[model samples]
Target: MNRLTVRAAIHVAAIFAIYLSVAMLIPAAVDLFYDNDDWQAFAFSAVLMGGLALAVALATQGRPPPVSTRFGFLLVNMLWMTLAVAGAVPFMISSLDLSLTDAVFESVSGITTTGSTVISGLDQAPPGILMWRSLLSFMGGLGVIALGLFLLPFLNIGGVSYFKIESSDIEDRPFERFQIFTLSLIGIYSTLVFTCALCYAMAGMNGFDAVNHAMSTVATGGFSTHDSSFGYYADNMAILWTGIVFMLIGGLPFSIMILFVLRGHVDALRDPQIRVYGGYCLVFSLVIAIYLTVANGTPFLQAVTHSAFNLISIITTSGFASDDYSLWGPFAVVCFFVATFLGGCSGSTTGGIKAYRFLILFELLANGLRRLIYPNTVTPVRYGDRTIGDDMQRAVILFIAAFLVLWAITAMLLGATGLDFITALSGALTSLTNVGPGLGPIIGPAGNFSSLPNAAKWICTAAMLLGRLEILAVLVIFTPAFWVR
Candidate 1:
C-alpha cells in the first residue's frame, strides 16, 4: 500500500488517540481536586486508549493512506465505531455499573454529540464521569467540524463548495497550508469554548460544571451536568440567551469567522449561510414562542425561555431543554422535529440536512415559477447570486431522498427490536440525523435512553454512526464493487 493508504486508518486513529490522551488527563486533575475515586476510572481509560493509539501509530508509522471515495466512506464509518468503542471504555470502567451495550451506546451518543444517556442518576454520578461525558461530546463536536473541513467537502454535500476556503481539513491541500488552516480553526474553536465557559460560569453554574457544559453547549452537544438539563435553572432567564448565542457561534462557518477575526472584515459575518441560518432561528423561534404564549396559554417568560433555548438547540441540532417539550402539544413536537432536518450551516458542528440546501431549493422553486409565468424572463436561480446548476439541484434532491429512505429503513429495523411506534420512529430519525434528543416521553429532550433494550441499543448505535458519516459516505462501502479490491 502507498504510505497515505497505509496511514489512512491511523489518521483517524491518531486523532482518536490524541483526543483520548488529552481527555484522560482531565479527570486526573478533577480527581486530585475533588478527592473522587473516579480518578481510577480516568487512569485506566486513558492508559487503554493511549496504548491502543500507540499500537496503531507505530504499525502505520510514516505511512498514510491516500483516501479515495470508497475508502473515505469506510474510514468515516470505522472512525466513529472505533471512537464509540474507545470512548465507552471510561464509562464502562467507572463504578456506574453500565453494561457493555449501554456504555457503548452512551459513548456513541457522546462522540456523535447525540447526548442520549443511559445513566439515570446523573445528579449522583461522579464528577469525573460527567466531565468525561461532556468531554466526549466536546471532542465529538470537533470530530464533525474536522470531518467537514476535511471530508464532507470532498463528498460535495449540500453546497460546501462555496467555502473553497482551505485548511488542514481538506485532504488534497498541501501540508503546510492544511496545518495553517487547521491550527487557525482550532484556535477559533478553542476561543469559543473558553469564552462560553467563562460566560456560563458567570451565568450561574459552578466553575467546573460551567466549563463542562460550556464545551458541550458551544459544540451544540447538550451534555449537561444535571439530569434536569437546562430546566434545572428555570429561574435563570439570561442564561438561556447566553446558550443561544454560543449555539449560533457553534453553528457558524469557521472560515468566515477567521476572516472576520483577522482583518475585522465585518461583512464576513454576512456570509450567505450565516444570514440564512440565523434568519431561520429568528423567524421560527418567534413563531413558536408566539404560539406557545397566545395559542397554548404558556406564560410569556417561560414561553420565550423554552422556545428560544429549544429553538437554538434543535435548529443547531443541540439537544438541550429548558422545559419538557413533550408537554408543549403536537405543533411544538412537529416543529422541533422539522428543525432537526434543517440543521445549522454546512461548516457547523450541528448535524442534519442543513439550511443552505433548503435555501437553494426554495430559490430554485421560485425561479421555476417565474420562468413559467413569463417565458421570456431569464431568471437565474441563485444562492447569493451564484446560479444554481442542474447537477447541484439533482444532488440536493437525491440527498434528501436518500436521507429519508435511510431514516425509514433504520426506523423499521429499530421497530423490529420491539420498541413502541413513537420511540422507534423518533429514535430512528434522531439517530439518523445525529440530533441528540427525540420525541415522546422516554427519549424526549427531558428523558434518557437507559431504559432501552440491548437490541435497541445496537440499533441506535448503528443509527448514530450512520448520521455522523452521513448516509452516502458509509452506504457506498456496502456495494459489491467497494470491496472488490
Candidate 2:
C-alpha cells in the first residue's frame, strides 16, 4: 500500500477510536451514579484512548485521500482490533480482575455480538460495566450493518455486490446518498431499540435491565444481566414473549425495515430472504416445541413459548435461552447445533451463513439435479427476481467452503489445547458463527467461558474477528498477493 493509503486508513481508524472513546463516558456516568469505584477506570481509559486517537489523527492529517479497497480491508480489521483493546481497559483495571487475555476475550465477544462471556456473577456486577458491555454490542451491531450494506458491496466481498444500490440521476451524488441512507438507518435502529426497551419495562423489568437488554436484543448481542439469561425471568411470560418479538426484529434486514418505515408499505414482507428466514424459524420452533411437549412432558403452552424464544434466539444468533434446551433431548441438541449455522437475514446484526446464501445454495442444488435428469439443458439459478450470475454463485460457494474449513481448523486447535471433543467443536463453531453458547458441559448454555485456557481465549478472539468480517476480508489481508499491490 502507498503512504497515502496507509495515512488515510490510520486517519479514519483514529476517528473511529475517538468516537468510541466518547462512549466510555456513558459508563463512567453510570458508575458515578451507582457510587462504584469503576468510574475512575472508565474515565482514565477514555482519556488514554482519546489521546492516542487524537495523536494519530493529528500526525496523519493532510490532504485527505479516498481509501483504496486494499486499505479498506486493513482499516476495517485494524479498527475493530484497536477498539476491542480500548474497550477492554475497564475490564482489566476494574475489580473484575480479569487477566489481559480474558479481558480481550470478553471485549471481542461483546464487540462481535457473539454473546459469549468469560465472567460470572453478572447479577452482582457493577451497572457501569454491564452497561458498557451492552453498549459495545450496540455499537458493534451498527458497524456490522454499515459494513455489510456499504463497504462490503463496494469491496465486492462475499457476493454482496448484488446488494449495491443503484442511483438515479436525481440521486447521482454518492456521498450524499450514503449520508442520507446512513442517517435513516440509524434512526430506524434507534427507534427499534427504544420501542423494545419500553416493551421490556412494561413487561416487568427495572429501567436499567430494560434498557440494557433492549440494546442487546436490538443488536442481537444477547448479553443478559443474569447468569441464567432469560431464564432469570422464567415465570415472566410477557418478558419472554417480548424478547422473542424484538430478537426477530433484530435479525430482519435493516434495509428492508428502513424501506418499510419510509414508504409505509408491506414490500419488506415480500422479500425472498425474509420469507425463508421466517419459515426456517417457524418450522424449527414447532419441531422443538413438539418434542418438548410430547417427549419431555413439558406443558404445551410453556413448551411452545420456550421453544420459540430459544429457537429464534439461536437462529438469529442472539444466544439467549429461557431454559436449558440442551437438556430437552439429544434431538433438540442436534437441532440447536444445526440452527447455529443457519443465521438470520443478510444486512442484519446476526451472524453465521446468512439466509440469502442458503437460499442461493438450495437453488443451485435444485438446478444441478434438473440438469442431470435432462442433458444439454441450461438451468439458471434465481434469487427472487434476479438471475444469479456465475461470479455471484462462485463467491457464495467459496464463502461457505471457507467458513467450514476455518471452523474445522479452529476446532482442532481448541482440542489441541485440551478441551474435550464436544466443547472444542461447538466452541469453535459458536465463535466462528458469533453464536454465544456451545454444547457440552464447559461452554454450554449453563456454563460460561471463564475456565478456558489463555491460548484458547486468544484463538476464540481471533475467530470472532474472522467471523464478524465474513472471513475473507481478514484472510485476504494475510495473503501474499494482497500485499504485493
Per-residue lDDT tens digits for candidate 1, residues 1-485, read 23465367656666667577667779767876789987888887788788778788766666455557655666677677778888888777788868899989988888888777778878888888888888888888888887876766676554444354322223343335667777877888889999998988898878987888888987788788889888887778877878888998888877667667754757657667778889889887888898899888988877877798888888887888888887887888888888888788777788788877787788878888888999898876676745666666776776778888988887888789888889999998888777777888888877888788899888888888777765666677678886666
After superposing all C-alphas onto the true structure, candidate 2 shows an RMSD in angstroms of: 2.0
Which stretches of candidate 1 lie above 4 Å from their native place? Answer: 1-7, 11-15, 65-67, 158-162, 165-176, 367-381, 389-391
lDDT of 1: 0.78
State the lDDT of candidate 2 residue by residue for 1-485, as single tens digits.
67787788888889898998899999999999999999998899899999999999999988776657897788888888888988898899887978999899989999999999999999999989999999999998898888877778667677455465211111243335667888988999999899999999999999999999999999999899999999999999999999999999988877767666775547546878888999999999999999998998989889999999999999999999888887889999999999999888878999989888998899999998988998799978888876878877887898999999999999999999999999999999999999899998889989989999999989999999999998989999889887775
**Model 2 off-target regions past 4 Å?**
165-176
RMSD (Å) per prediction: 3.1, 2.0
- Residue pairs in steric clash, candidate 2? none
Give Cα-based local distance difference scores for all models: 0.78, 0.88
* Model 1 weakest lDDT span, ten residues long: 165-174
